[model samples]
Target: MRKLDNNEDGNFNKKISNSPANKRINLRENPYVARIRDETESMRAYINYETAKEQVRRIDDAKDLCDEIKKMSEDLNSNFYSNLEISNSFGDIHLEDIPDGLRGSVKYIADNTGWSYLSVLLFVLLSIAAATRGRYIAKINDEWLEAITLYVIVCAESGNMKSNLLKLVMRPHESFENRKQAQHAEKLSKSNNVDIVIAREIALKQSQKNHGKDLVICKEALKTLANNVRHDRNMINDYCPVEEASALPRVFTEDTSFPKLYATMQDNGGGSTFASAEGNTFLHLVLASRSPLDIFTKAHGYEKFITETKRDGTKILQQPFLNIGIVVNPDIARQLYSNDRLGLHGLSPRFAVCFGGKQDEIVEDNSSKSDYNSYSEKIENLLEDNFTQEPSRKLIEIQFSPEAKEQLLIILKETEKEQNRTPKGQTHYRAYLRKIRGLVARIATILHIWGHAKPDNHFVSKNDVLIAKKIVYSISLHAEYAFSANGLSAYYDAQKILDWIKRHRHSFFTSTQVAKGIEKMKNDNIFPALDALEKLNIIRQLITPSKPRLCVVHKNFITSA
Candidate 1:
């Protein structure tokens, strides 16, 4: 995310086209550094010159380690799935497995733009589920263990056609809802018995306690009634938000204030999706909030969440039905990753993150708006087909086949073992494996429903589970990419110092000279950063009887930078 000036581009890490496969090749021609660049091209990612060099070196080191693991796993078990050959790209999704009508459009858009097919395809799928989250929870034990709600994020540059692609994907869903909300509102407006009076806010338990009656029974009855009433409402994503003193309907909000979003969800049915391309807006909201998003974290586990707001003296026993999708930059990605480390509930980790970069300039040939409509309409049509019974419809329980469970168990065991062998600081993101199993199950159920993969019994089959594995593996790679990108931000200052050292050609510089180079370097971190640079072999330290202790920049760093 660092801005590169023209002068800086001379040795700016031999940049590559930012695709998921991320084909390692320099953007501009450079005959002098071509040999080293070509040698490192296949392994390095687009990062600071030194960091990318370090990454290439580390990758070279890991090849031997991977070889060791391969040998060990082969000796222990031949069916080990995580290997170099299989770890090709983020993941490969068979277009045939995708629900009909989605593959063509998603692929078309991705192909036309500099976006990955998997990234675009997954975005469309998650958005579909997001549009239809409420009234349709995928169940595993007939008890709705799988939330069916999803949170996915893809980080890319602004010019990467993120907004355009989203607009095309979202068009049909929004259009369908706009029409449905109109019809529902019109019908309600015409109704004579519709409740126009606002309900008074008084705790029934307090009243029952005052009356010397059983408060528990009263609260229980209230809870049931509240749930029933909320369910009975026409809960669909409303484009126009309701005004103050009016009931706020369900909405697919983008970059909204949490408090307003929270209130809107409560008014509608305590479920909503926040899908946004402008990720910084949400970051700004979180930073400006009175407290961090506890609801978001609690929602992941569907924990016993309660919110009592002082503004309206309102209390809500919030449900864990919220979904989110956002496109973010590296700065916000770093911030979210850091915040995830700070909290016990861990809002940031709950999100399934994917990263994207600029791809080759796509063919100028474009798809028409109507073509976009055709794909989004397929999603809308599927949503209607799933929830045909409009008013009082409920989620259908889709059980997993017995064999599916066995397959899932095997995947879980292998994934956990693989994670155990992961290098330190990288495996922290694997903690979400506790939830990912259920998430994969939910996605399988969703795919079954969407694809209409007709089976003898109303249960998810092994085929569905297999598809889920591919999806989950892809998601894991994305999580690794995103979290790793954020980790690089911690060394931002160090990378800057490296750049300075390489540029200034300092063979032997004192602390005072370092001060002259960087007038405002952190007093405490300068020495540690220098030590780190030395450890990375980007620089070396020397001490002599005739001279003060001085640091010398590595000779190759100048070329590499």
Candidate 2:
């Protein structure tokens, strides 16, 4: 080997293989230089190819990471129930546990739709309440209660068939309204004809008097005729007023503004239901209006809601009853329950919350069509028995049995104890406990109506109370998970911390490291994130006394990193 010139050796790496300056080099003057130059060019080409290949690999890796982050975000939004310890602790609501009149329907609906029994049961209860809201009120322990109403939220991912569930449960109401609207149209047409005839008669009498030669006689006959016409008009008005036909009774709406909801309830015989598959969208639409949360609170308590709108003028809804049943994803549920205003304003406490189960968890179909038909018939029967097109309507009163009353007292005491033990700052927890008594009563009332054809003047049995308590307690577990900030919030924080760990290739680190590294990660958020990661076995914390606290990322996680 011969030593090359320093200038050539130094400039070789800086020069492109295809450059004009390199092509002009006198390689043929020495065979050794030509051989060396050829080898150098080949090596440069190899290096460039390998560098490009590595960059492509990095891009593929980045795409995979992006896909993973997107999937995680979706899971965090939709399937948070799977990771929630509260949902894990909750067992299924048995078919036997459901009210006898509704068990077959619950089973049928669950089988047909592949929805969980718990979700079906909730919808069933809400449907019954919506159908019978203005027609049946309960009296438990001498407390006069208006119709059984509930505020509910069902959390699930997309393609969970929530809309199908809602439609099935509300089928009876839909049928009832369609029939009523048709009947109303016919009656209104007839009423309009009667008004037309009366108007023609009055006009004829006035014209006859105007053209009469004997004014005195004509006036007397016209006054008598006018008196007769007025009497007939009064009788027709008393019999069937046009006001009833102006707007047919509405049982529920999928979505509406506050003013529209109020007007709908007014036209719906002082009660209305809000049911929707897209709960988040419905909530966002309504919550943007003024004081909608307050109106909802009032409606939950069956208080009077008086509002003034430019179009409707002053509208008063006495004993306004609202039953809400909506399905949403976990992200929306977290936003709703974590809102301080909603929690403190008593709207959050009125709701019973539950999350959907995994797709593979759907139970088998053992229910018969006859059983479902029986349930359907019962709902129609209730509608026919309670709902009427009459201008004046009545509500049947329900009472509780002595034993059931005793059970309710126990529930009351338990709720009071729980409330008293709750921390001061935890207003949502305290309010939820405080409201459990009424909730149980309402549930019991709905169940009581299910079994008996005539729920009026009948006492709710202890069995009903037990079943209601079971359902309430089961749903309350999920509600607790929903109201906690640590549920979804902690999951997101854990994701951030995990991503940081992977990016930095940290096998072991401390909370301080995470807090200092990630943006917007406060000390308050660090512990929950660590706890979540630990729960997933992605990391571990050391207990030894040391200068700095330490955590160990799992070997599996580090290997992936």
lDDT of each: 0.59, 0.73
Q: What is the lDDT of residue 251 in candidate 1?
A: 51
Best by TM-score: 2
Candidate 1 regions exceeding 4 Å error are 1-101, 142-144, 180-250, 287-292, 301-304, 317-320, 340-343, 364-374, 382-393, 423-427, 453-457, 484-487, 490-561
Candidate 1 residues 101-152, lDDT tens each? Answer: 4666766676676677667766776776765545455555655466567777
1-561 in candidate 2: lDDT tens per residue? Answer: 988799888787667766877766745666888889899999999999999999999999879756654444334322122232222235778778887777778888888788778988898898888777666777874555745788888887666777888887888778887887888788878766776667656765654554443535577777876676676657645654544347766666654566676667776667677888878656675456355575687777667778877886987766777789998866576677777778877887788887864333455565556787776677777776666433235656788889998998999998888777767777786788877878888899899888777777578999989999999988877766666555555655776787798899986787788878998888678777777776666666544454335576666566656
Worst 10 residues of 2 by lDDT: 77-86
Q: Could you say which candidate leads in lDDT?
A: 2
Every model's TM-score: 0.60, 0.70
Shift of residue 104 alpha carbon in model 2, Å: 2.0
